[model samples]
Target: MQEHSHLDVGDADPPPGTARPGGRTARNREAVLDAALGLLAEHGYAATCVQDIATRSGVAASTIYRRWGNRDGVILDLAGTLVAEPVGALPDTGDLERDLTLLGRVILDVMSNPRDGVVQSTLVAAGVHSPTARRTLAQIINRRVEDTKIIAERAVERGDVPADTDAGKVINTLAAPIYHRWYILGEEPTDDELAGFARVAAHAARDALLT
Candidate 1:
């Protein structure tokens, strides 16, 4: 397992000699990022190397070096891409229970998917010690929390939750137990357990306890 560093997005650009090539260059860049993500999912950050990524991506080592500067650079870019992909996009079902249940299902699906789950775990492990990685993870999580806040806001509009509820905080609280189970206790929630969690969160929100 790769050692983790807490991350923060830094202001560093690709080093002095880098080129911003377009056209096929863009394609290569995408390929490289995909390759990096795949490797990170499989081998983790410490084990993943730039040369291996170049081989998997079919991009030249020189290109990766020129484009990203280093292995951490590639991983950071990969983290950005991974985190930007939306999760838990709930439908406007009008019923809060159904919507929240759907959201819980989505969360469970993503957290349990082999590829996504491994990639997430690997990234967090990398983030433990790396400030850049830590920042990247924080940014990704913040985006997710913001996205989840939409659900709370909608619930409020529908009179399913308190108007004064702090959406972000509520969402985070709702997710806390799930994350604790997975990350800390190394366990997955069963279907019933997942549903129960969602119910509790929804009721808590409805009762104005999530303020």
Candidate 2:
């Protein structure tokens, strides 16, 4: 069975010298990405190749190479797309706990999708010894940190969190457990587990900010 998976708003174009599709090229490129994702899901990163992607995408192997330098390039492009357009924004329910719960749910929804397994695997592989993968992961991490900062700032404005709180730290504490479970322990958090983490994280952040 093909592994299930999951992109970006403006600036949808791939890097320069790659595929610049207008009509047919666009369609074909999209097909290629879709196929690549499917193969990644089914075969994992190491097993996937240009030939496999080409066959799945119905594009020529040369075309795949011309667009994406190699498998790593394609995977990096996919990761970039995933981060550029996150699934949703952080909740702003005014209640910090409630907001965290909602955010946890959103994260769980994304991670639990079978398609995301490919990403998870790719990231794990990259962690071992791929500078390119490291760079891509770092970009995503930085973006997420910025996003958490925004959430913390919003909380401060609403008087839900203290003004002196280090938003980055708070976010790290909240996110660390989930990532550890998924990437390190090989355990995927269920919705219930995510909610629990959210609760604990919210409470901890609140205490740090307010107390």
Candidate 3:
């Protein structure tokens, strides 16, 4: 496979070579990450190289290796930063159904994004071939699970869901279908489809656990 060139970071020049230490470091890191993400999206994992990332980021290959170790390290860092941003906090509209519908919409919006799709595809491929990749991906997802647990706990506290509701299952059900459709079947979930999943999932949880 031929290696692709790095992403152009546009004409916005980095600060002069002698600028403040903190700002320069931040800019370089962001540039590297942005370029890496772009390249990963464009070329997938196999064709991307450290030299490409450095060229795309306008940094030195030595600098990238020093900073991120290797290609896997760069991707791990990217996944960490990307997943760290919390999606909007779980909705609490006083109605469990309505709140879940909102959550479904948010999830649909996230999964349908092309950038997210690229990241998912790269990670999935990596997980199949690299133990480190699999573990890193697991960590990223575990954090998301923790976030969902908090939402589930809040729902129980508000009497929107039963205390014994399997929060993990509830959360997984909401996302699994969409993920399957997108990543497994290569089909994006429609808004109506997402709404239906949310409705059915919420109803099942209610009937089974909430009496």
Candidate 4:
């Protein structure tokens, strides 16, 4: 998301007579990323390759290589885009339960989407072989945590939670069960279950009852 600004390198600034650097670079990125995502959705991770993406997107493999470094980089960027949430902009309904439920639903919606789910599953498969994929996934999770941390901070400021409350823990607790259901158990949770998850997590955080 906006959590990793460094990963979102836009087009370069214009120097002399050149048009916007982002014009072609940005177009190429969009095309390549779209192609990659479509392939991941249709054929899955292992079957998709740079050459296939290049052919589908009408871009060069060298360009994709130069821009993204490898397939892992491309998938990482795709994952980031799929799950991009604005930093520090979590829902504020003045009630911790509603806010946490909103956050949990957002997470579930993102992870359970068809394309996003395929991307995540592919990343997990890649992680078995590539240390870089594993690290990138961890960084993505950290970024998500950072983005959601503001919710807990606001709850603390509103006297809903302790100043020493662990934001990461709270967020992770809210997310873990949903993630387990989808990613580990390969089960799709109903809306009521998602709402219950949010309510429990918020209640736990509010009472400081969770260890």
Instruction: Name the best candidate (by lDDT).
Output: 4
- Per residue, candidate 4 scores C-alpha lDDT tens digits across 69-154 of 77777888777664464543578898877888888877777675666566767877787888877776677677888888787778
Q: By summed lDDT, which 10 consecutive residues of candidate 3 come out lowest?
A: 1-10
- For residues 7-94, could you state the per-residue lDDT of candidate 2 as single tens digits? 3213467456644445566667667777778887666777889999888878999977887888787788777766675445678777
Tell me the tens digit of each residue's lDDT in model 3 across 19-97: 6554666678777877788887777788899999998889999988987799887787677664665556777777666
What candidate 3 gets wrong by more than 4 Å, as runs, is 1-26, 114-117, 209-211
In TM-score terms, candidate 1 sits at 0.80
Runs in model 4 lying further than 4 Å from the true structure: 1-9, 12-20, 23-26, 65-70, 80-89, 114-116, 209-211
TM-scores, one per candidate: 0.80, 0.80, 0.77, 0.78
Which portions of model 2 show Cα errors greater than 4 Å?
1-21, 148-150, 190-196, 209-211
* Clashing residue pairs for model 3: none
Ranking by TM-score: 1, 2, 4, 3
Candidate 3, residue 115: how far the Cα is off, in Å: 4.6
The best candidate in terms of TM-score: 1
Alpha carbon RMSD to native, model 2? 3.4
Ranking by lDDT: 4, 1, 3, 2
- Quickly count the clashes in candidate 4: 0
